[model samples]
Target chain A: MMLKKVVVCGVGLIGGSFALALKAAGAVGEVVGLGRTQASLAAAQQRGVIDRIASDWADALHDADLVFLAMPVGQVASVLVSMAPYLSSTTVITDGGSTKVDVALAARQALGAQCAQFVPGHPIAGAEKSGVAAARADLFYQKRVVLTPLAENTEAHIALVEHVWQACGAEVSRLDAEDHDRVFAAVSHLPHFLAFALVHEFAQRADSAQLFGFAAGGFRDFTRIASSHPEMWRDICLANRSALLVELDAYMVELMRARVLLAGADAEGLQAMFDTARTRRDAWLDGLTPPGE
Target chain B: MMLKKVVVCGVGLIGGSFALALKAAGAVGEVVGLGRTQASLAAAQQRGVIDRIASDWADALHDADLVFLAMPVGQVASVLVSMAPYLSSTTVITDGGSTKVDVALAARQALGAQCAQFVPGHPIAGAEKSGVAAARADLFYQKRVVLTPLAENTEAHIALVEHVWQACGAEVSRLDAEDHDRVFAAVSHLPHFLAFALVHEFAQRADSAQLFGFAAGGFRDFTRIASSHPEMWRDICLANRSALLVELDAYMVELMRARVLLAGADAEGLQAMFDTARTRRDAWLDGLTPPGE
Candidate 1:
């Protein structure tokens, strides 16, 4: 059997890491990296993440069986539509965008019947750093990657995408685009929003540097996501505003309850609140116990 | 040189760990553990965290030049006042309490002229787990142990406490209790508050089990503090409420602004907000690039 030819567009962190994973799994015969920056394309090739580099998108996709649009979430639509001119009807298109609803919608409008081959995906793995320079082959190992497929999606197309993810060592789950958005809004978007809000608030405080100086490991890790790409996050928050807003309100109500309990010096009530949380979260930890290798 | 005799009261996590640190450093000739529980005292001695277990408070203070009271902030003053009956005028006492302002004042009212000898200290090192069994010799290594000593504190007393921290491999910083409370309110208490709020908000969502399943590394680390000792945290939140409430107000204001920005889909404003936080916190990461061991 001939190996699949894989093309990764916008060879930054996500795209570069995916290319590395595909090559490592021996699932792809050759990886072609296409990035806007000529220097970045060279960097990706130099890192051995890709066998070849293409400065132009069409050149990279010319003989590829799979094309991955790993650009910023906001840029996924326009880039996908732009690639429409060079796309073969048989080619399988996939994305690793953070926000899925918009990307899934874009696939429908841009590719229509061909959208059956476009699998919208989101891998819940990242570091604060960005670009191809920060790419690692094992970034997606043991991570959860959610796929949002419409009724138009064919089983063969889904199998091809699922095979790639399995080869990359990801735990794959399928859900509707709207459900994906709501779920991610709680787990991912709210966290990023809180992280951004926290550090930004401290930056504007009088003793900003000193405040950061006193910050220990917990604070650093908690706020690390605040250091992610602003352009990407801003697009994510706007795209999924209603869901994010609801989670935000829920957090506020809980916080005020704790605050009021503290104000009254109700030690018993406060301890009970913490006890309940610890019990619930401990159950979660036990379920995923020992962590995946 | 003769090793100093040291007594650690309430041999739970903090006291047991302190005794272990002191004994490991060879700073104490005889490390004695005193607590309310017989099982913990037995574990402390069996683990070599203490040379012997002292069942009575008066007996524990007999030959000690130094004493460390490692109890909740709310209980620190009463314990000191009771133990004062048997303490020698020259024997210096210290505490591992979270809030120094109240403890310092309590020392003043209870210890009177002996307040100069009761140094207020807090070691900012801990884990989710507590008890004598969890005690380790290296717990305080490379950790910060802040001392809040008043003007009446004699040089000999302050130096004695500083020497103990140095022996335990802790970096010691001396600051006024009020400033200590203000700084920690932002760095420690506020993060706990936010973590508790987040866990309560999302961990109780409709699909909490799945959200917990997909929670990434960052989320797990950020929320780990929510699993801390509830009774202990209740005392921390209440004793330090004045400073913590201020920090809470500041955070809520920032959250309000973030809500408006997200609600209005203000892309540029949100982008700027995230960008500034990224630059600021990334600088923190750069500045504290961990020193080679």
Candidate 2:
């Protein structure tokens, strides 16, 4: 199915890449950019990520077959409220929000009956860099895109979102909104939180420079996510706080166990844990499609 | 000053790379390999990481100008005790142990008066892959090699160690043994522990498969160190337990603060911490020399 006009709100890495991917797939005729900044929209247009920049929700949703919300999670409620009146019945809405439950709540509260059109999604792809300049058509290639369909969403509307993600070279799967948030809080948000906390702790130390000076490849990779967008991660942490707290507490228990092992010099126990982690991680890595293939 | 002969114990990634680097720099005449396994030593010899596989400490240390102990931290004490009888008065010794204080103690207990000849060092360079096969002549190129010299170490002996690391294209810096352990416990060891704990915690969960399936780039990098050599890390953690425990406890405090911020939905506080972390990490990354230069 071809989308004659697709409106992408945000015009940054996620939105711009989505627009470019759809155009490259020859599945979208025109991509309209809508965002908080006209300059960023102009940047997306210049980068060929969007065919045009929309000045208002009225113009953006006019004849739009799909509307993608790709902004930070915290902005979803207000943006949905602003665009709700302009959304046509046939215009299926989806999002690239990392947290699904919060975005689903925002859509339900804002769109009311039209929330049926909103299929909450999260594309499991990112880079160290962000913004329109970092956007690439192949960003979603071989990546996973999870959809958390609301009870109000019709099969056809959910299928439309799935088709769009598939057309962009992504593998699509569905999960309940609550399950989506909980799983991601355990896998994604919790790790990001730990990384940020570790880095921040080191940065606040008196010998931070000396400590960082000795940090090598392991330290580099382990804390790489600490370099992610602060406001974006902050929103995610707060949005998925309950699930994240559960993860954080579980992790603390694990760390405490590790400390006990270290304190008692339990070499066998520590090695067992590390071995299990490595074995599982290696198996998962082996199952993945290597990038750039 | 070129080495007439160099003996490397435990010819794995760290030791194998050192032999190769020294050979590439024409800093040593002959390299002798000594390890617990003859098979690995033979493999190192076949890869040209060592000129010969020595049958004993006497065979390895005979006429050797330097002895480089590159074994796991747990093996160092026993190895030092084994080699102490063969060590000549002028044979300056060094190590690539990740922990300094423990290695220092090992040297003192095993070598006694000969401890002055041992210059404790840690090369801040590593890859996800290990073993002699993964060794490269350029492994230490542009990397940091920290020397934690003993009070009894003569300036000339310490200079010889520094010059050798420099010949391998490393920038050598000196820190007190105590300071080295403390700094590295915070920067390097703590991050690895956290990564391993995070991965192990998830791997043990009932929903492990689901959580891992939804995991993305952030999770990948954050837990990359979880795939490290389990035995090696266990030894490092145990050897440097005191300092690592301090760092780990401090990090838990930081994580607790983060939890409070999330629980309270204090968006401003969470963003501030993330901002600080990202800013510091970005600056640290900027100051690093780009690899392969």
Best by DockQ: 2
Candidate 2 residues lying further than 4 Å off, grouped into runs, are A290-293, B290-293
Candidate 1 local lDDT, B121-240, one digit each (tens): 988888878888888888888888899998789988998898898788888888889988998999888988788778866666788876786677667766888777777788889999
Q: Find the number of clashing residue pairs for candidate 2.
A: 0
Candidate 1 Cα lDDT to native: 0.84
Pairs of residues clashing in candidate 2: none
In model 1, state the lDDT of residue B228. Answer: 76
For candidate 1, what's the RMSD? 1.9
Two-chain DockQ for model 1: 0.72
Model 1, A1-293: lDDT tens digits are 23468888878889999988887887889888776788888988888988888657678667778888888777877887888878887788888887788888888888888888898898888888899999988889988888888788898888888889888888888988888888788778898999899999999989887788778876876787888988878888988898889878988888888889878888888888888888776776777752255
Local error of candidate 2 at A204, Å? Answer: 1.7
My TM-score estimates for the predictions, one after another, are 0.96, 0.97
Whole-model Cα lDDT of every candidate shown, in order: 0.84, 0.91
State the weakest 10-residue window (summed lDDT) of model 1 chain A. A284-293
What i-RMS does every model get? 1.3, 0.9
Model 1: lDDT of residue A288: 75
